[model samples]
Target: MAFEELGRFGVWRPFGGFGSEDARELEALGYGTLWLGSSPPGDLVAAEELLAATETITVASSIVNIWSEPAAKVAESFHRIEARFPGRFLLGIGAGHPEIAAAYKKPYDALVEYLDALDEAGVPAEARALAALGPRVLKLAERRSAGALPYLVPAAHTASAREILGDKALLATEHKVVLDADPARARATARPRVDFYLGLQNYTANLRKFGFTDEDLTKPGSDHFYDELVAHGDATAVVDHLAGHLRAGADHVALQVLDDDGQATLRALAPLLREVA
Candidate 1:
């Protein structure tokens, strides 16, 4: 239940954003983990590269979509990574969206089956986590895996999830950050990202549970909705917003900086990482 390995602050980026140099840089900057987003392949070559590039930072899949990646294959990838990198790898699995996956159906049940396969394949429960959102899946994550990696949520949801996960389970929340002082400019960069997810039912349903109105979820999203999901402002303010998740009972916060190449933001936040850590 203790995910002390991942530490407090982690970086979340797509495959293109994270490379050998980037991994080394983030590691040097004191980031405890690097999450490979966008449903990384079952083979996990990208994870291996990052693991080999850095000496200590944990590398995790934001999620290997259960609908796309066979549980057995992912379990195999887990073993391969663990064998080479040891405790530096964490497998993050999820059902993804119904619209995107042709095989998506009874997602909760599919997740249960996938976990069973992983268990059969000898992947330790502590070695993986789930991209959980709802109460049911959150409970599943607590019972079956290391913890929950809920995405695009506010600190309030972290508090709610911690109540469900209790004191033992690892609760890592993924929060977007825009390191821009201008509110308009920040929201301009964040709106498209929010809009894309608004088209996905799972994300919208989760947002609604936290009191987001139908109006708030409409295309382009409301200003309040964007502000709640994405922390914007200077480095100090962004770090403070991310810390809300930790204060809300989250053990870790994976920050996804919105902009071209998150290097500048990461560099700017290097000194401030300890505040959130």
Candidate 2:
């Protein structure tokens, strides 16, 4: 139940985005974990490569879409990585969007079944996390897995999620960052990614729960919405905003730099965040 390995903040990147050098640099910068986003394959080779590259710092999947991956196979990968790297990797799984997934149905039930499979395969709950957004799945994460790792969420959602998961479960929320000082430029940078998530029902539903209306979730999204979800501005401002999640009750915040390759943003924020961490 101890998530000290995850530390105070982690880097969130797309699959195949980081090389061995990037992994080492992030470890050197004092980031506690590196999370691979965009539903990596069940083999988890990317995770293995990163873990192999770095001496410490946990590497995790932001999520592996359960709709596209078989639970048993993913569990096998978990055991493999755990055997080699031990506590250095965490498995994060989700049901994904129904619009894109043809087989998506009864997601909550499917997740229950999937966890059952992992359990049968001997993958311990504490070693895995769920890509949970709403009350139901968040509760399930609290009961069945290590905790919830919700993406594209604001600190308000983190606070609510903390209420649901209580104090013990790992609450690692992924918030995007655009390190531009100009509000206009920052919002522009965040729009495409925010718009992409808006098209998905799950994200919209979760946003609505946090008081984002149709206008706020509309194309281009509102400035307030952008500010809430994507931390922008100078490194100090960005670090302060990310710290909001910790204050709101998250154990860790996963930083997904929107425009940069993640290196510059991480390097810039590392010093300021070290004290916070």
What are the candidates' C-alpha RMSDs?
1.1, 1.0
Residue pairs of candidate 1 with colliding backbone atoms: none
Tell me the tens digit of each residue's lDDT in model 2 across 121-205: 9999999999999999999999999999999898889999999999899999998999889989999988877678878899998
Q: In terms of TM-score, how similar is model 1 to the real structure?
A: 0.98
TM-score of each: 0.98, 0.98
Worst 10 residues of 1 by lDDT: 14-23
Give per-residue CA lDDT, model 1, range 1-277, as digits (tens): 2488898999998855697888898898898999999999999999999998889899999989998889888888889999998989989999999889998889999999999999999999999999999999999999999999999898889999999998999999899988999999999999876689888999999989899999998888999998899999998989899999999999999989887658889889878877657
Candidate 2 wrongly placed segments (more than 4 Å): none
Best by lDDT: 2
